[model samples]
Target chain A: MVRWEPGAEGRLQAAALNLYAERGFEQTTTADIAQSVGLTERTFFRYFADKREVLFAGQEHFEQVFLDGVAAAPAGASALDVVASALEAASAYFPDERRQHSRVRYAVISANPGLQERELLKMATLADAMARALQERGVDEAHAVLAAETGTTVFTVSYRRWMAEGEERSLAAVQADTLADLRALVLAAG
Target chain B: MVRWEPGAEGRLQAAALNLYAERGFEQTTTADIAQSVGLTERTFFRYFADKREVLFAGQEHFEQVFLDGVAAAPAGASALDVVASALEAASAYFPDERRQHSRVRYAVISANPGLQERELLKMATLADAMARALQERGVDEAHAVLAAETGTTVFTVSYRRWMAEGEERSLAAVQADTLADLRALVLAAG
Candidate 1:
């Protein structure tokens, strides 16, 4: 139910991403994207409020993945482990076939400061949601906040590595490696 | 020089804070803040870009403390230790005298969602600065990123505790406790 289905919304998003990447986000307009998909600007507006929404369309489902993972953790799991499970769950959202799309999306975002801020806001929202979920699971508030933030940091580092040139590992594997590195750093605190 | 010196800027900021708290951030205006300080609105603009600037006026020097601490870290310190040094450095920025000012400022920001986003952005920027400083110190990329983010999380949790009603711990003390808890969580990960 989450993938870009062969629907008007999907077609508009695909076209918008392609145009935004090729022509640059600033240089592309909603009409250009809609026209590329053989649709009118009105149709594009019907599906997306504007151009940026195309880049953020999956955010709700993506956040739900993290919340669901946090809720599913065992009662006795450590905060870090609970967060790791959430990070692992997010990997399913990014399959091997979607890597190119992700890479392009990352590029588009990197090229725009506004998009970058929006991306950071989205991550902050995810952290807040994960912390609340953990709290609901009977985790203490401070621990939940710390672990949820740590989860976002791991996801950020892993996401960058996944998008790095010539990187072949899956997002889950990269996230695991990053999580391990974080634990090692924490354990090695002098 | 940073401790709200007895000058027009300091008076304006203090007055703005008090008025924002009493009247609410949305209800207070620049003219009201200026008039409270017996200054003109034009004079107030000479000191702050806008009302929000009053809340963030100390951010630059605050960030400098982190960068300085990171730069001055002993060559062999662990990444977490380096981050701890930075966190300790920042504590001086929030002495007991400024605690009430901070509490009021926090309330004002908390009352407005936009201001909260700005605060998060400021924290994210601090993390980026600390990460770069760590990398410059030859710490590995992953470790630097993770430690810097962990440092911000410690700061956030500790600051909240510091601002909590009936809480009396120094910011640095709270930070140490939070850091220790995080390390414990990381060590206990399974």
Candidate 2:
């Protein structure tokens, strides 16, 4: 049993995503989101520090899972292998029910420069965390950083493909394909 | 004769860097920057769209040079080789006198999340552009993208090392080291 009930938080997220899609992220206010969700503005604030925070609440948890997975990877695994395993572990955390909402959120983020910047920052933070985790596993600093970056790039490309055409694909499958593509690309270049 | 006035842009960039470092990016207005150089705000705006633009104006010219260099790379040259040549060409365009201002600008940009995101987006855009350029030169799409990403990663790591404390190596030398590091990392992983 999950200790944390995904109730008001999830409701607020769904409400916020709908409103953001309907009225534009910039046009929507906290009060409006709270009112639509039949909650007080205070309730909304309790869940999200700010409007931007709503889009990023999952990042902390995701990063933790990713880092743990990397730390637990095989002793002799390469940095990329560690990161790839971590990405695979992280994939299970993304709920399938939220795919549509996730796509909408990405669309909104893509259109807004401020949101896009925040998204990039989040990704960079995740990469840095992963790099540090790899370093803890005896990987060299530069190799660890490169592996983290490559992993993030693979995730990015795979996520884009998964989101394209509004079609649903297993995160594991997409990630696997992305890694294969990366390996093939590198080999061909070599 | 060169069409553009030499060092005019450099002087403005230097002025902006000093003001940003002294008063912080948000606190230092464009007018403050222009006044420091004995120029008007209009002149500042003419050169830069906003305060942030001053830090990024050279990016376009740099990308153009890189793209041209990549295009002119020898047939059968490895993707890394092409990217390395492009980085070398781009390095020649970065004036030695700008190093101090460049460091100052990087410091300001690093401290601000907003600027950092825009910087990442710009780099992503450049990578995509470089991938497309490579594809146009007969490289497959997936391979081209991966090659471009690898090159960009090397460039980023090299630039960071160049900017790090007690690192007196030339940018070109740093870039070379980064490429070698990347190759070793990838090969070891494989």
The most accurate candidate by lDDT is: 1
lDDT of 2 by residue, A62-92 (tens): 7998887787788898777788889888777
Model 1 ranges with Cα > 4 A deviation: A1-6, A22-45, A49-51, B1-6, B23-45
The CAPRI classification for model 1 reads as medium
Question: What is candidate 2's TM-score against the reference?
Answer: 0.87
**Candidate 2 off by > 4 Å:** A1-6, A95-98, A166-169, B1-9, B76-81, B95-98
Residue by residue across B10-83, what tens digits does model 1's lDDT show? 88888988888889988999999989878788888878999988888878888998888887778999998999
- Report the C-alpha lDDT of model 2 over B1-190, residue by residue, as the tens digit: 3334356566778888888888898898988887887777877766788988888887878799889889778898877677777788777765555566567778999988878988988888788889898888888865677678767877777777677767777888888777666555556663
**What's candidate 2's i-RMS value?**
2.6
lDDT at B86, model 2: 78
For each candidate in the order shown, give its overall lDDT on alpha carbons: 0.85, 0.78
Superposition error at A139 for model 1 (Å): 1.4
Per-candidate chain B TM: 0.93, 0.88
Chain A TM-score compared with the true chain A, each model in order: 0.94, 0.91
lDDT of 1 by residue, A17-84 (tens): 99998999999999999889788888888778889878989788999998777867888888888898
